[model samples]
Target: MSRVFDAMMEGLRGNLLRMGGRAEAILDKALRALWERDARLAQEVADDDVEIDRLEVAIDEGVLKALALQAPVAEDLREVLAVKMIATDLERVGDLARNIAKSAARSAANPPIPFPAALTSLARSSQRVLRRSLDAFSRTDAELARAVLAEDDAIDRAQDEVVESMLRALERQPTAASQEVDMIMVAKHLERVGDHATNIAEDVILVAEARNIKHAAKLARNR
Candidate 1:
């Protein structure tokens, strides 16, 4: 029975990794479409979202089956629950990437505006956060997952700067409001990607350390 349970866990982990890899790739493609102003690539990103959705459903079903058959306890239970949470985060990341792709397509239709430096930094930072979070999960590295959490604040700041700069641009060139607004939406989507990555990192910490850090800050403040 233990052997069967172990095999089941391994299979679930493999599926989660495959899903994460696909989500990461789709995110990269979406960003490339935005940067390169490729409507075709943007459309591809939207079309690829269905794959992530399918994986999420599969992971959910696997989790239910594992719970019913294995009745995982303690760390095993934590691992199972964390995998489900991580899959949900990855699914949201895919959705946000599709939103960015839509913004990219819209921006491509209009005359190109100078991409804000802050927006560029936000995009890069968010992508790095997401990649690092996924890596931490793959290795079950609590330290790396904590580091990913630390980086989330900087991504948030970068996003704010991007928004402020875009607003200023809006003020200066009212005629370009549509492009600026699209850029603002793109920045927002990227920030949300960072948020989802942070959630994944938190789940990694849960599985690695048996700690639930979600809402820890708020809980501490209330205390």
Candidate 2:
């Protein structure tokens, strides 16, 4: 029974990793579509999201099976629960990537506006946070997870800069307001990707240390 439980855990881990990898790739393609104005790549992102949705369902079912049959306890229990939470975050990331792709397709239909360098930097930063969070989970490295938590703020700041700049551009050239709005929405979607990455990092810490720090700061402030 113990050996079977271990095998179940391993299967869950492998599926989670595959889902994470696919989410990351879809995000990259979505960003490229936005930057290069490639509508075809944007369309591909929408199609790729179906696989992510499927993996999330599989992981959810596996978690239920593990709890019902294996009855994981202590660290094992935490690992099983965290896998479900992280899978949800990865699924949301895929959804956000698809949203960005939609924005990309819309932007492609308009006259090309000057894409902001800050937006590019924000995309890269968000992607790094996601990759590092997945690595932390893969390695069960609490320290790396904490580092990902620390880096999320920078992505937020970069996103703010991009949004503010886009707003200014909108004011300056009201004729291109539609295109500028798309850029603003893309910045928002990228920030949300970072937010999901942060959630995954927090789940990593939960699994690694059995600590629940999801809203630690807010909770402390209320006290």
Candidate 3:
């Protein structure tokens, strides 16, 4: 029974990793579509979210099976809980990416706004966070998880800059305020992606070290 439980845990890990990979791909494609102003590509990312939803369901099932069959304890319990939490976080990340893609597709219909460097930086920083968070999960590297937490400040600053720039644009061109609002919304969604990535990284830290590091991350940032 112990061997069976171990094998089931391995399968659970594989499913969670696969879900993470899919969510990461969704974010990458969404960013590319936004940067390139490719409506078709953006729509494709939105459409692909159906698959992400399916994967979420599958991940939940895996978690259930692990709990029912393995009755995990101690480290095993932490691992299973982490998988469940991370799966939910990845689902939210996928949803945020899809929202960004939809905004990108909408922007394609309007006259292209000069893509601000701040917005571009925000997207790049968020993509890096998502990638690093997944890598930390895969390796159970607490240091890598902490690094992801450390980078959140840059993402937050970029988000602030992007939103402020859009607000200024709105004030300058009231007639085109609607388009600026859409751009701001996209920036907000990307910021949320960064947030979800941070949450996943925190979950990895908890699973690996059995310490709640999220509060520590916040305290360290303030210091």
Candidate 4:
């Protein structure tokens, strides 16, 4: 029975990792479609979102089953619960990536607007943070999770600058207003991606250390 329980746990972990990898790919492809202005690729991303959604459902179901059957204690319980939370966060990332793809499709319909350089840079930063956050979760490294938390403010600042720049450009060129607004939406989506990744990192800390550090993340970063 113990061996059976352990095997189930391993299967659950593999499912979680696969979901994470696919979610990350969705974000990457969405960003690519946005940058390339490929409506076809954007639509593909929207379609792929269903798979990520399915994975989230499976993860939730697995956790519930584990709870009902194994009645795990301490570390086992923490891992099962934390996986559900991580799946939720990853699902949000998928949703945001779909939004980016939708925005990209809309922007592609209009004549090209002046690109916001800062926004692209911020997108890259968010992707890096997300990758690191997932890595931290896989490795159960709280310090790496802290590094992910430390990068949140940078994402916030970049989003602010991008929005301001887009607003100014819209004011000067009313004709490109629609596309400029789409740009802002894209930037905002990417910002939310960073937030979700940060949340995942926080969940990892809780799962590994059995401590609530979400509220204290900012204070730690300040130190």
Candidate 5:
């Protein structure tokens, strides 16, 4: 590869990593806002999502241009595809974080209730998974990526518990139904965050070994 092309690829990687960090930050802020019932912080998280969206579009455009100009093949093609997938996942993570922030803002504007314990646990786990997956991608560590995949099940279980708790809360205190509903949405958003993180981890596998683990088994016996 030419120096310019190499620099372009490196720039893309750096931007993607920055995007991941921003997404994580947004999620963390949203969670803090939810915990503290801080409407301003929630709105800040939502507003910050615009930058992540811009980064996603710029990364995709760069990838398309590089593909056309460089005509990457074999491992290079896999890397390009993986970066595209990782960017998409990070963008979605940002969207989900925005959603949580919106929910938190709504809740903050309303009653004086607290966030659910189960949901809070789930959100923290989901955030950890998101960061862990990004760490795996930065290090190109497939084993750590696989560990992130394993964390998704715990999030799912926590989500189910949160849903049941919200439903019961709705039954007992119909007046605070909106708050209960917010809890449900937050749980769902966090669950989806975990899902997106898992997706990024799968993409990391592809980037590390040019193996598509989503379709094949343990990246085609490379486990």
Candidate 6:
């Protein structure tokens, strides 16, 4: 029975990792479409959401099964619950990426707006957070997970700068409002991606250490 439970846990981790990998890919492709103004790539990302949706369903079922059959306790219980919650977050993250891709496809022919430097930085920073959080979960490294939380501040700052720059650009040239709106939407998506990754990292911390550091994270970063 113990062996069966252990195998189930392993399977759970494998499936969750697969979902995470696909979610990360979705964000990457979405950003690519936005920056390069490639309608084809944006369409491709929008279509890929079907796969992510399927994975979310599978993960949900697996979590329910683990809870019913194994009756996980302590860290094991945390892992099971975390898988369920993280799967939901990853699914939403995928949707946010797809939303950006859809917007990119719509604006592909509008003559590329002057690209904002802060937008690029936000995307890169969010991407790093997602990658590092996944790595921390794979290694069960709480310290690495905590560092990812710290990096969220950088993402927030970048988003703020992007908003300010966009506002200024709009004020200077009201004709550019249409383009500025899309740019702000893209930056907002990237910021939300960072937020979802932060949620996942929080789950990892709770699962591995039984520590609820989420509230602390908000206060610490605000300070």
In lDDT terms, how accurate is model 6? 0.87
116-202 in candidate 6: lDDT tens per residue?
Answer: 899888989999999888888888888888898889888988988899999999999888787888888888888888888888889
lDDT of 1 by residue, 89-158 (tens): 8999999999999988998899999999998889889889889999999999999999999998898899
For residues 105-144, what per-residue lDDT tens digits would candidate 3 score against the true structure?
Answer: 8787888777778998888898899999999999999999
Per-residue lDDT for 34 in model 3? 78
Per-residue C-alpha lDDT of model 5 across residues 130-201, encoded as one tens digit per residue: 999999988889999999988988999999999999898898999998888988999999999999999999
lDDT of 4 by residue, 1-223 (tens): 4886798888788888888898889999998888888999999998999999998888888888888998999878888888898899889999999999999899778787767889989999989988998899889888999899899999999999999999999889988888888899888998999999888888888887998777685688899
- TM-score (C-alpha) between model 6 and the true structure: 0.94
lDDT score, residue 169, model 5? 84
TM-score of each: 0.98, 0.98, 0.93, 0.94, 0.93, 0.94
**RMSD from true fold, candidate 1:** 0.9
Candidate 2 displacement at residue 63 in angstroms: 0.7
The TM-score of predicted model 4 comes to 0.94
Residue-level lDDT for 51 in candidate 4: 94
lDDT of 2 by residue, 117-158 (tens): 999999999999999999999999999999999988888899
RMSD of candidate 2 to true structure, Å: 0.9
Model 2 poorest 10 in a row by lDDT: 151-160
Q: After superposition, how far is residue 100 of candidate 4 from its true place, in Å?
A: 0.3
Instruction: List ranges where model 4 is wrong by over 4 Å.
Output: 217-223
Please give me the total number of clashing residue pairs in predicted model 1: 0
Go through the candidates in order and give each one's C-alpha lDDT.
0.91, 0.94, 0.87, 0.88, 0.89, 0.87
